[model samples]
Target: MDIQTLRLFTHLAKGLHFGRTSRACNISPSALTRTIQRLEAELGEQLFFRDNRSVSLTQAGEYFRAYAEDVLQRREQLQLQFASNRELKGSVSLYCSVTAAYSVLPDIFQRFRRGYPQVHLKLQTGDAAAALPRLQNRETDIVIAALPEKLPGRIIFLELTETPLVFIAPTDYPGTVCHSTNSEQEIDWLQTPFIMPDTGLSRRRVDQWFAEKKITPHIYAEVAGNEAIIAMVSLGCGIGVVPLLVLDKSPVRKQIKILACSPPLVPFSIAVCTIDKKIRSPQVQAFWNIATSIENAYKKGPTPHMKNGVSKN
Candidate 1:
């Protein structure tokens, strides 16, 4: 019935968990239940099917979720249009990996804060793999992510930097996984224990690399975040592939060593990505412009020096 109500519904639709949605929306579980009940009563239809163990959207809920998202997006646009002359206000949610938050966003945040003090930046950090899906779901306005091989049509990305994907092994562990092999051909891929990403761009790239080499990897573990992979490798779990940027920023950097491969893994083009419509919001546009300016500055500036295969500006 109202913007807040619609927001709650849409967020719940995405997560499909009453407890998480209630906590995120800053409402008590009882209040959230009452709110949904009120909405269902008003609409004369059940929106979600809830049981003790699971929650799911009904057919009506799916249609209403789409409607709610459109309405919320349009409201943001309308607000932006009406307040053209006023100071830019409203929040822009951002999603990125923890490494990106530390390495990539500081300059952009500093500039944005100085220019638009009234605007709020809500940052959420997790696996880089979730960035695009969260953006598509309208959960976040902007994301710092690696540019995928084939970008989705609904999203726009601005390249910020490029980082090589490298293999890493434990420095202290002199196990079979960390054995010194002069070249890719010398190593026995079947016997080597390897840590790999469970999903996302890096995972696909690694998969392709293995396929081209015509070798089935001896996977030790499948982890979610690159940070986690670094941690596991540092513990002598297995050699893992991760972005050089992530490795450089990792706390256990000293515990890990980069391994040379015959054919190096393709580098990742890190970028800021957002849906086409969200970019049109005034606050979101301001953030994008700041990122754009930074990107342009980097282009015009001297090339960053390479430190242990990581670029340093």
Candidate 2:
């Protein structure tokens, strides 16, 4: 199979959804189906189990996924090796939440492009929680993510910035689910309808905060992305806990108000994460170096501070 075909297959295998894969790959659904069918026919094996509701990788598909990823990665390496005498001319896949793309990526992208204009950057924005998993699965070369409490040994994290985790509620909600209480005892933690993260570093921090207070949170909804939680909270559905960075970048910032928690939730340590093996790639290394320079500049300069859900230098 060709590099482009293998890339499409690997992306489909990771997401396991036809519509999403087709949209992300910029291909018609019917065309994508035909491509997969051709691959299966060429291999003489069923790669994916497809039905009306869901799609899943078959046994053969799982095996081929590894092979496909290896081939794609090697192709990138070979391209970089040949272009060493000239300019860097390869693609780097990046995954991050939309908020990160807006807040964190602009400067880095500007600088990287100035240095290596030939390097193509493929960015996929989605739930922040999925960043590490996508990186580990080799669906992307690098990801912007929060530093997990227990970092995997195979992953390398370079700190970019930190933001406090804060509780937020709708400003014009009809009910009294939230109040401006200075003490934790004054707030009704057990009765409040909390919108929590489905999984990720923020979820773990929120759970730990609740456990420390010895209060079982009344979870009203479990959302996948922090942006979704913000949207839900804006609709007067329930209060949510999210990073200050996300809150700052949200379009509905005026609709939501940050609530006071006596002992505030732990701040998130945002970073650029990549697998150990991928770090050796020239394109990946170039991106990593730019991120590292930004991190060092932040350390040496006056860091921005958050106030009233806004960042000020």
Candidate 3:
């Protein structure tokens, strides 16, 4: 099979969703199906088992994923070796949260673009909660996200920087129970209305805090993104939890105040994560090297918490 068809199969194997794979590959659904069918016929094995509701890789398909990845990595490496010394040309797809895009990407992009002008950089932004899933699904080549307390075994991370997970409340409007205070007793966390994250590392951390404190949150809303939580908190809807870097870059930074809890939440490690196999590609390695190099320079400068598309404060 041709390399392009191999890529399609690989995406299908990872995604298990025809529609998502089609969109990501920039092909029509019919064409994607045809490509997969052609691949299956060539191999005399069905790559995917499809039903009305779900799609999954067959055993043969699982084995081929490793083969496809290896082949693709070699192809890219060959191209890189033969290409001119002056320029590198290829595409790198990246996924990150909106806040990370604004706060950490500027430095990386500035340096990357200057060195590899011909590279086509495709950036996709969304909630931090989706970062790991998208990377694991092979939907993106790289992801900027917070490292969970128990990181998955399949992923490897180049830790960029760290930010504190702070409690925020509205400064202009005071609530009966939620207010700006350093003491745990001064603010009734259990009784206070909270704008909580619906999913993500932040949500898990929050849950841990609540469990340890033996306090149940009076959740006002289950927000999907940190930005949304910040917005709700600014409206005086309730107190919320967010990374300090997010709060610092927020347009409504002046409207909210950071609270001090009795037991400070563990800081978040902002990082660029990728599967172990993907790093074999020359393009991935090049970018990873560039990203890791930024940490030292980042530390010597103004904010020690920011680097490698990650921030902590």
TM-scores, all candidates, are 0.83, 0.75, 0.86
Q: lDDT for each of the candidates?
A: 0.84, 0.82, 0.82
The runs of at least 3 residues in candidate 3 whose Cα sits more than 4 Å from the true structure, single-residue gaps closed, are 42-44, 63-67, 84-86, 176-185, 295-313
Which sequence of candidate numbers ranks them by lDDT, best first? 1, 2, 3
Model 3 clash pairs are 162-312, 163-312, 163-313
Question: lDDT winner among the candidates?
Answer: 1
TM-score of model 3 relative to the true fold?
0.86
lDDT tens digits, residues 1-313, model 2? Answer: 7887998898899888888778767899999999999999999999999899999999999999999988887886787678787878779999999998988888889889998899999999999998987776667888988877677657877777778889899988947384326754366766678998999888888889888989898899899999999999999988989999899889999999998776988788888788877787888889888876753322222764211111111
Relative to the unseen true structure, what is the C-alpha lDDT of residue 169 in candidate 3, on a scale of 0 to 100? 90
Model 2: colliding residue pairs: none
